[model samples]
Target: MRALIALGGNAMTGPDGSAAPEAQDVAVAAAMEHVADLVAAGVDVVLTHGNGPQVGNLLVKNELAASVVPPVPLDWCGAQTQATIGFLIMDSLERALAVRGVRRQVATVVTRTRVDSEDPGFSRPSKPIGRYLPENEAKVLVEHGESWERRGDKGWRRVVASPEPLEILDAPAIIELAKAGYVVVGAGGGGVPVVRDADGTLRGVEAVVDKDLAAT
Candidate 1:
């Protein structure tokens, strides 16, 4: 039997929403206990995980450092967190399996999900991200043509387009790895949202994809 495990971003963070490396390591180690059991029981497993918290933190960092360094784009932030979270999952899972005397190859793919360039989601940015900013800060960003939305008593946050995922470009590779008796991890943060150009080139977009939808 084969199973695909989709872990939420919270699974790798502290209960209080900390994304520190040590906190992530502990969280991933705990989650991998179950995954190791599945692998040990002869189940092929493929893993996908959310990066909401991690990527949000990255965006906050981008904003905090904008004057010192170029701010990373949303797509790039997704890619960064994918790799960061993937490393934590892969390493912890390997240790978990080893503890059970199970030997298996583990790998993570830097995946991409395609979306239509004309998706209506682009015109209406609705996915909120990063730490909420003070009214003054939020207004400053809005004045610069960025989308900011208020959430209840919380301050304001940036909102980005969240389009449906059309394809997991690395699905074949992920499947092949799982079939070859490897524990595969892929499609982190809905696979770094991208769109194909008319000239056949693919470009990353400043959008988010629902990780659950992409996992499906």
Candidate 2:
């Protein structure tokens, strides 16, 4: 049987809510122990993971370095986490499989999801992201045209529209990889949200997608 595992963003964080890279790698290594067992049982496994915290952290880093370097866009942050988490999974899975005497190929696909440009979610911007900020910082972001929402007890955070995912641009690659008996990781953070222009070309938007929906 074929199986697909959806790893939540929390899976990459520490038990105490820390998201440091070392903590995340430790978390992923633990998760892979379970995954290797599944593969050893003869189940074909594919993985999808969340990057909400990772992307938010990346955005925070971008903000801190803004004076000396340009800040990265939100969609780009998603892409960064995709590569980071994917690499982590690939390396760990390879080692886990090796230790279990299981041989399998691994690959990471940069995934994209299509959302209508006219989706009402875009106008509303309700999905919370990035680091929480104080009133002054949040106000500064709001004044600069970013969407910020005040949490009831958690200060304020940047928000973005989360439109429904209509299509996966990399489904073909994922299927082919899985069918070839290779474990694949893709659709990180539900894929970097994108919109196709009238010319049928794709362009990324500033949003993080839910990885569960992306995996489905």
Candidate 3:
């Protein structure tokens, strides 16, 4: 049987509520133990992950460093985090497979997901992102055209329109990879949401997608 495992950032959370690299490694290693057992039982695995927290922190870093360097766009930021985290997951899983005497090729695909251009979310950004900010800071950003929303007792956070995923642009490739007995990792950060322009060319949008919802 084939399996698609959707991993979340919380899966890598440390005891102190942080998801540092070391923490992620430990967490992934533990997950690998379970996955290895499944592989031994003859299940082909396809792993997709959500890097919301990591990508949010990355955006915050870029924003904080804007004065010293130009801030990267959200699409680029998403791609960067996917590559970074995908590598860690692929490598860790590969090592686990190796220790279990299973030989499998692991690949990370830079995937894109299509969303409707007219998605209502565009007009009303509600997807929380980046780090939490003080109410005053959030107010300033919102006043300057950024979107912010309250997070219960925590401060507000920047939000972007999270549209529904229309299609996985790389689904065929992912399926082929899984059929070939390779562990494929893709769809990180909701697959770098994009839309085809009138010219039939693809361009990324300034929004994120829900990984779990998109995965379906």
Candidate 4:
């Protein structure tokens, strides 16, 4: 049997909500223990993961360095986190398989998902991201025409549009890899949202896609 495991961003964060690189490595290693067990039991595995914390961190860096460097767009942020987290998973999983004497190849795909240009989610902008900010800082961002919303009682956070994922552009490659007995990791952060232009060229968009839907 084949299984697609969908890991949330929390999987890569410490219990105290820390997303430090070492913390993420430990978290991913723990998670891969179970995946290795599944593989040992003869299950083909495909992995997809969320990037909320990771991408949020990237956005914070972008904002802090905006004066000295061009800020990466949302789609690029997704792509970056996909690769970063994918590497963590691949490394940890490989070690786990090695210990268990399970011979398997692992790979990560830089995936892209197509979304409708007219998706209403683009206008609403409701997906919360980044570290929560105090009311004063939130106000500053709002004043600068950025969307901020209160998430429970933690604080305010930046919200971006979460468009629906219509298609995963790398689905074919992912399936082929999985069928060839390789453990495949793909579709991180909903595959880096993109839309087709009038001439059928694809371009990245400044929006996030729901990872759960994209994995399905």
Residues 1-216 of candidate 2: C-alpha lDDT, one tens digit per residue: 988899998878999978999999999999998999899999998899898778778878866665566667788888888999999999998899999999887899989999899889998899887778888767755655578888878899888988889999999999998888889998988999999999999999976666777777
Give the RMSD in angstroms, all C-alphas superposed, for model 3: 2.5
Question: Distance (Å) between predicted and true CA of 190, model 3?
Answer: 2.0
**Could you give candidate 1's per-residue lDDT for residues 43-110 as a string of tens digits?**
98999999988987887787776546666788899999888888888899999999999999899999
Tens-digit lDDT track of model 3 for 121-154:
9989887778887787566556545677899888
Model 1 regions more than 4 Å off: 139-146, 149-154
- Given candidate 2, what's the lDDT at residue 142? 63
True-vs-predicted CA distance for residue 148, candidate 4, Å: 5.6
Which of candidates 1 and 4 reaches a greater TM-score?
1
Arrange candidates by TM-score, descending.
1, 2, 4, 3
Report the lDDT tens digits of candidate 4 across residue range 108-208.
99999999999998888887777787777677656655688888899888888888899999999998999888999999978998999999999998888
User: RMSD per prediction, one decimal?
Assistant: 1.8, 1.8, 2.5, 2.7
Candidate 4's C-alpha runs over 4 A off are: 132-157
By summed lDDT, which 10 consecutive residues of candidate 3 come out lowest? 137-146
How far off is residue 169 in model 4, in Å? 1.1
Q: In candidate 3, which residue pairs clash?
A: none
- Misplaced by over 4 Å in model 3 are 134-156
Worst lDDT run of 10 residues, candidate 1, spans 137-146
Full-model lDDT for every candidate:
0.89, 0.86, 0.81, 0.88
